[model samples]
Target: MALLDELAAREAAMRWLDERTQLGTQTVTQPDVANFPFNGQTVALLLRQQGICKPRQLDAALSIRTTWTPPGGKPPYEDVEGPDGLVRYAYRGTDPDFPDNRALRRAFEHQLPLVWFVAVAQGVYLAQYPVYVVGDEPENLRVALALGNQQRWLGVPGPDEVDRRRTVERLTKLRLHQPVFRAQVLGAYERSCAMCRLKHVELLDAAHIIPDGKERGTPIVPNGLSLCSIHHRAFDANVLGVRPDYKIAVRRDILEEIDGPMLKHGLQAMDGVSLTLPKQRAQHPDRERVKERYEEFLAVG
Candidate 1:
């Protein structure tokens, strides 16, 4: 089992590296020789040294390595020689002031893929912020300054675009549905309606205790509840609510004025019954958020 797990990990790494290298090739035009030093041959050689043969295995390993790197600190940069004994490219620290020696040391310590991803992500991040080039302008410095100027005009840092891309990548890995609020709520509820235990994904909705439109961007799961259409509408309109302790409640006004066996069976009968919980214990709604909603429900006119 241990050997199998190790093999699986290696395979995953190979896949990740292949995809990332492809993405880098597609996205980075005339990438700084200092930043992307490894050519195809160099990458192949490195993978061989690490005992990785398959592209898929290389990618998976690189993905894990990239994701695990520390969030902050100067990125690693260095120069690598091609098979022809020519300097193919140089890896430069993302921060111009970052000492190349220290950065390279850290890169070697953690491995190149980790450093590469950090630099790529950081470069995308820094592209968003204002860039000011200082000191007597050498030719290369002047080029960087010109790029910064163009970045400002083009909104090159494009934080929103970068964030969206990162979000998609991360969420994809987690297998999360788009429109995260609903996905998160449904995920917690295992795609079943809390009120009816209806497993029909299409019939269920991720109802917010405080309607999202009203909640002003607070989309925490504790502020959410899973309900079928009828129950969700009822709860949203204040005809039904749940206490912090999980006890169901129906407004006296709704119970008195409504007359139907369906209501009695579906809504009123649910009174005093507890909500179905998530399969995983950790996915349960936060107690504090639930309590706050419960209190607000009580205070509503």
Candidate 2:
């Protein structure tokens, strides 16, 4: 019945999460979270019923979570990024003085890091760690969290203001939208590659049909494809492409090249093969975007 000290528990929990998360390729299931080893006892890494979790055993807040929002629904907490590139997390409840909110405030004051569990599906989460509370806005009853220490170098927002703004946008897209995009895409396609049907979740990625940097490249399910690492790289490099009709196309040079079995079976064989889409019709890739990309693929070759 021994409990781990505050720092020990946070560190241990992060190590446990790292084992499960696979550097953003994989997700942590509720079962894994529930069975977290704390000292000699098993403790849940996240709160099951609430978004903000601060178990009595720990002095500061342990984790904050946002559960799966049904299609067309909004998340309980709107974690928006400010102009400074920091992600703002809302207070636990409407009340500004909730104990959980207080715990999170304490973590910010002490410079302690906390885990943020973003749900990809029911009972499944993508864990982002070492999240520091860099800004506390009591007027809004929310705290701003930063994933990178770039804020230290940027400093006080003066001469480099435009550069700072651009940096903020880029950081927001990468740190927040990227992970959620990957999670949603992978989840939509049932964690299998659309081109090859590969089932290694840890080796799979969410490939954007429309590049995320483009104005039209929204991080939504229809604009993404679940792909294995190899396929994702190939797609990005224009070595392979998918037509609007859902057929795959490997670049002519690649198909004709004499290479290892990986080329023959992996890329060439997938040519002209129709994409295996998600079971749910709503999760299917957008045909118009697919066509636009396919036209690029054609012109490049």
Candidate 3:
């Protein structure tokens, strides 16, 4: 009799879900039956089926609990209430679980769409946010999840392009600032400065090929060049430049100057040299991005 009652309950649950489900075009994936705490995991799977596949392209961060948790037993990722009557997600410091967060951060850096699914007693509510990793504070690394204003985009049926564009810009401005972005870019360059081949982890930075504010700029490894702090600054300030052909160039005025060993070897010696590229050709600096930034450097010089 107990077995029959359990079966009946499962049937009722499936029927309730099926009525509200927006089934995937390719396959109708059903929920897991045997697993305990099935609802939250089930909602996550349904979200995956509802077009959040390809971690490199699209993703969703899910939480069965109302708040997100951080690593090292830190406080839960916070929700800051706004005057606009919406709650925004925020996290600070290194997520000790960074490896697990790679896919989600990759999606954010590329301006790829992502959703958040939280399982509630009634069902699941899907939310979208313009995710960003703001630079660190004295206490911790800061990340923000502003409401993306993407109703239809997150599978909520609505229309508002103005808000969508604004949200996108807000998220795109800090591609280089995120820990995940740094991890990926540094990983691609083998944790060495691409220009100087500096191997010290503390000295290296994930330098963007183009400034983050530019339309074409992104945190993708192909758009990044691992550079040490000084060289990274030089690259950004147009003191050093990289051509699309993978050759390096120091500003002509700086190169011609007679200076001490530091200036001579540090900057001028690298002039007309080839960059140390990633082993994978795909991870090599994007030629178009190099061309764009190189042109800007030439214009400034």
Candidate 4:
């Protein structure tokens, strides 16, 4: 193998080792454009495992451009053919000697400074591949790779920034809908609970306005209510609802029962209370859905 190819192989090996070690498993095959999707963090993990801990090494790796194409037909761009007649792709700069080659290289030489960009972008693209069957667009792949890389690097928040990056990456894959829902609800509720005025993030739950299993579609902002756990469970179980006018309501019987004082003191006090309007009014729950849910709650008891 050439020097750059040797480096790339070593980097790939190191990454596999790192993953194996971290996972407490034996050595496995390296991640690549084929078996395991390649990204910046994967490259970085490999480099770090191999003791190439300098940013310069990362920069060099990021500068490489690997070949990617559809299963059949010519690539959208030109590629340089090797002795074996297969097009060779490098992660580094385009082969300066073959200026006329149709091979399109994903630009990374100037964009490497945005650390983890490769991994994040590639990871997202890879994740969507099964669903969307993303095609090989060099530029889009570059962006996806970079984004996936950066996201992976920022996995989790901790003493080690790398760990934090990794955590974020994993979370991104697992709960893709969470951030969108949280942003929408928080924006709608002005970052406070509509019921308890709970502004602290740790104390809040993005309670689904309509339960997930109840024909409510996804847990989007329009289908969500910002509530503390107490209120969230109550809302889910039909103990609470929001009127079409955005006023809170409690089940009448729950409020009137002889043993209702607890519900009254704890939840009934919220009845008729105006919603804590969101800063971005556009994010507020749809009145129609809320009204429908309210009607449903009324029928339950």
Cα RMSD (Å) between model 2 and the true structure?
Answer: 3.1
> What is the C-alpha local distance difference test score of candidate 4?
0.46
lDDT of 1 by residue, 1-301 (tens): 2334334443443354445444222111113211211223223212211211223213222210111112234323222222221111232324333343232333223322321221222122101111211111122211111012222233212335665444433332222111345555776687788877888766777777655546532555556677888888877776777887887888776667667887888777877888898765555666776676667667773
- Against the correct fold, how does model 1 do in TM-score? 0.43
Deviation of model 1 at 154, angstroms:
13
Tens-digit lDDT string for candidate 2 (45-92): 677688777776677787888788877888877777776666788998
lDDT of each: 0.43, 0.81, 0.52, 0.46
Off by over 4 Å in 4: 1-57, 60-174, 213-216, 258-262
Poorest stretch of ten by lDDT in candidate 1: 125-134
Output the better candidate (2/4) by lDDT: 2
Stretches of candidate 2 off by over 4 Å are 1-4, 23-25, 41-44, 148-160, 252-262
Error of 3 at 105 (Å): 22
Q: What is the lDDT, from 0 to 100, of the residue 279 in candidate 2?
A: 85
How many residue pairs clash in each candidate at the backbone level? 25, 0, 1, 41
Indicate which candidate wins on TM-score: 2
lDDT agreement of model 3 with the native: 0.52
